[model samples]
Target: MRRDIFTDEHEAFRDMVRQFIAREVTPYHEQWERDGVVSRDVWRAAGRAGLLGIDIDEKYGGGGNPDYRYYAVMNEEFARAGATGPMFNVHNDMIGRYLDRLCTPEQRERWLPGYCSGDLIAAIAMTEPGAGSDLQGIRTTATRTGDHYVLNGQKTFISNGQLADIVIVVARTDPAQGHKGISLLVVERDMPGFARGRNLDKIGLHAQDTSELFFTDVRVPGANLLGAEGGGFVALMQNLPRERVTIGVFALAVADKAFEDTLAYVKQRQAFGQPIGSFQHSKFLLAELATELAVARAFTDKAIAAHCDDELSVQEASMVKWWDTELCNRVTDRCVQLHGGYGYMREYPVARAWADSRVQSIFGGTTEIQKEIIGRSLGL
Candidate 1:
């Protein structure tokens, strides 16, 4: 399917992203997987390549391009290269929206520069040990004490946890207020009593660092609060649609890459007397996958366009996130099966893709959670 979502300029940017990955990412991805984290140098390289903050102001070292297609291009190229080590999407699409939209002028001036420069790594601490999908279950608390809020809690499954220089910690400001009491505090590294626990070992995404973070009576200045006090839930709600849309874009990219790889594999691998793709069943399966990919690409591109125009609703974003991630997982699993025994071997890219794709349906809100959101929106 011909995608009209991107202009020539976007295609040009995609070329740069592809070259950047070939040079700085693909070579060291295996080492990063073994190390359980990516190198800081790559982050600097990404910053230099102008890939860190596309939507941020050019004055702050960002590309100043607010178009979501630029991000979609980046995501597609990264997925194509199988470069999962760098959390550029998380930094650029997820956390960047929060900072770009909600950060006060003073906060922007203080953090945006390093953020754009990739000197400051950022993570949002929303999923605590007890609260994965349920925000109301969060136990982290931040009590006001004079000029500072005393933060104390633990967060697990935090992407970029160990490398994060600044963390936006979600805390309960008023225990009685439930969701209304939730607030966001910008917790800088080396703050008193702020500590990172072990780098967590996960089932996949070996190159990406997910870790446990603990805050024990860490005093964060009032100036560090992001948005209005007790408005954390509102802030999160505002940005989640963008995050969900971003996840959908990446999911489609992953599925497309897997399909492309499988198509090549089936043509080369012989079964019986000829290529496996010559078999009726294999040919039909390939046809089905290719058709599905085209359909998914069409929807995702439309969603991206709507998102760019601020016209995408929460229900639509949730729909895209769940559908595309689940589809990606299905496509990758089938691709692995098509590769036979070679698919299970870690040496094959499809094998790693299989492992990495498992979590897509689980994160950025699970398929079940997404369904719930959509159902609620239907007044069910």
Candidate 2:
């Protein structure tokens, strides 16, 4: 399917992103995988390339483009390149939305410059040991003091945890109000009693650093509050559709890439007397996958357009996230099976993709959680 979502400008930006990845990321990705984190220099390079803060104001060193397609293009290119190490989606799509929409003038002045410059890596600490999808169950609390909030909590499974200079910590400000009590506090790395526990070892995305963070009586200034003092949950809910859309976009991109690669592999690799793809069963499988990818792409692109227009509902975003990620997982698994023994080898891209795709259905919100959201929206 021909995608009309992008124009010449987007194509030009895509060229720049591809070149940037070829130069700054592709070469070092393997080493980064070994080191368990991407280099800070690549983040700086992304900033210089105008890739970090596309929607941020130009005065803050951002491109100042409000178009979300630029971000979609970046996400697609990164997935196509198999560059999973850099959490640009987390930076541009997730935290960027919060900072762009909720940051006060003072907060923007203090943070946006470094954020746009890639000097300040960012992460959002929402999931805790006790809470993953259930935000209301969060136990992290921020007790009010004179000029500061004494924050004490632990967050695990935080992307960019080790490298984050500014973390948006979701802590309860008034436990009595339940969901309304949650608030966002910007916890800087140098603040006293703010500490990173350990860089977690994950099954895949070995290059991306996910870790545990702890705040023990860390005094976050009242000024560090992101939006309204007790509006954190609302802010998170508002931004979640975008986050889910971002995940879906990446999933579609990766599935497309995996399908394309598998198509090439099956066409050339032979079994018996001819190419494996010549076999009726293999041909039928490819046809089904091709159809699935085309349908998924069409839906994803529509969702992206609706999202840009702010017309995407939470239910629709949940549907897209779960369907596309699950499809991506299924498609990658089949692609690996098509390759037989070679697919299981670590050197094969499909093998790595198989490992990497496993987490998509789990994060951003689990598949079960997405279904629950959709179900509730349907009044079921």
For candidate 1, the clash count comes to 0
What ranges in model 2 sit over 4 Å off?
A: none
Q: For each candidate, what TM-score against the reference?
A: 0.99, 0.99
lDDT of 2 by residue, 159-251 (tens): 999999999999999999999999999999899999998889988899999999999999999999999989999999999999999999998
Instruction: Tell me the deviation in Å of residue 245 in model 2.
Output: 0.3
lDDT of 1 at 88: 90
Query: Each model's number of backbone clashes?
Result: 0, 0
The alpha-carbon RMSD values of the candidates against the true structure, listed in the order shown, are 0.8, 0.8
What lDDT does each candidate get?
Answer: 0.92, 0.94
RMSD (CA, Å), candidate 1 to true, equals: 0.8
| lDDT of model 2 at position 168 | 98
